[model samples]
Target: MKSSEADMVFPVLGFTPDGDIWGFPDLDTLTSCGSMTLKKNMQLDMELVDSRGRRWLVRSIRRLGRARPLVPWLIDLLLTAVPRFRIEQVLEEMTPLTLEEIKARASAAVELTSEYYCAEDERDEILVPLLDQVRAASDVAQIHELLGLDSFLSY
Candidate 1:
């Protein structure tokens, strides 16, 4: 593919557990072949409409990264088999970084992208605490709630 036609990331919504982990591309090309939704086997298909009212069919959603089915299966087995391992403990242990580490990395990225739109003091005083909560979030719901907080919404 030409550099100008390089793939752009597009978010996909699905019922699968790991769907949120990676995004996809090439929906237009994938759909032009045929509509695959009617088969109703392992493959999944869904219809989506663009802003311009164009209809498209999405087919065969697959995992984006290396499959580690065994690891998760083992973890699930352990969760059921072992009495001592709680889901909370497993989640904490599985998380690669602490909230503070997440905060630092996110802050660096945000500052770089902000283009000096907000002053350092304003960002530190207002945004940092909100982002601190965002980084500290343990679950998806918590992250969404934190994002909806007044401090984040006001700015």
Candidate 2:
């Protein structure tokens, strides 16, 4: 389905990594090919609240094989093929982080990140170092940029 402005498009239906199971209430379409424009009633999202005191509406998938990005409408929809995601929109502006807040947030982020990605040694190596940079960052912008997030950010 698409936003009311028609500027962004989202998928209502998603299959598991094995392509065996599907999700969402709309049971009409399941195949990997098709086109339909839908008016927004709901969006499926898995949100993560980062230590930076912002909430990210995230959709995630994991798999081993390579997956090519789909067309413009479905672009950045991270299936197993899509490794990670970038911020499409900033829901709100948060208060500027004080030096103490920055340090606390960075520490918290590192701990969470390490725990989350620790078990999966098969994951990308670059991300591990990036988190370390985030921990050592003196400014929030550095952390945000290192995460490859939010082109909308006016830096």
Candidate 3:
């Protein structure tokens, strides 16, 4: 089932590398594919706080596998100076789906990513708890809160 238009706030959904997923509450601040009116390349400047309470400006590239290698090279160069670093490439467009849909997708992504980097024992200890949080969230706000973005965004 589709989500009500009224329930549609922000279209840009963020997933942290550390296994937290959140959607921006401020629709005005989100630069979603559906909202961008410009023809030229657009840059999404997103700010997120890690578990350590350190703030990070995560620059997302809308078109993946299309940018000149120099762009990412430059970003890598810049990250050398900053300890906190994150990079996101838009893999697909955001669909207007219910919270359940979002959760399912996020959970699947988390599982896939976890499988890629985790050992067998590490998977049970780390991946299970993260996936459980996504499954247990009662609402979008709860998901954001569980992810710790609610506190991060407060400041």
Candidate 1 global CA lDDT score: 0.31
Residue 136, candidate 1: C-alpha displacement in angstroms: 1.4
Q: Is candidate 2 or candidate 3 better by TM-score?
A: 3
Candidate 2 segments whose C-alpha is farther than 4 A from its true place: 1-71, 74-96, 116-135, 146-155
lDDT of 3: 0.43
Query: Please, what are the lDDT tens digits per residue for candidate 2 over residues 1-155?
Result: 21121221122212122211112221112111111111110122422223343333323222222122435324544232222222222222224345455445544544455544355663457545666676677654455455433211111
Q: For candidate 1, lDDT tens digit of each residue in 1-155? A: 21112232232111112121111133332221111222222123333222122223333333222112567646744564421111100000112334344334434444454433356668768666766665775543344344431110001
Model 3, total clashes: 0
Q: Could you estimate the TM-score for every candidate? A: 0.24, 0.29, 0.39
RMSD of 3: 12.0
Per-residue lDDT over 57-88 for candidate 3, one digit per residue giving the tens place of the 0 to 100 score: 44444322212266664574466431111213
- List lDDT for all candidates, in order: 0.31, 0.32, 0.43
Count of clashing residue pairs in every prediction = 0, 0, 0
**RMSD, model 2, all Cα superposed?**
13.4
Residue-level lDDT for 115 in candidate 1:
37
Please state the error at residue 68 of candidate 2 in Å.
17
Name model 3 segments beyond 4 Å from true.
1-95, 115-120, 148-155
Off by over 4 Å in 1: 1-108, 114-117, 144-155
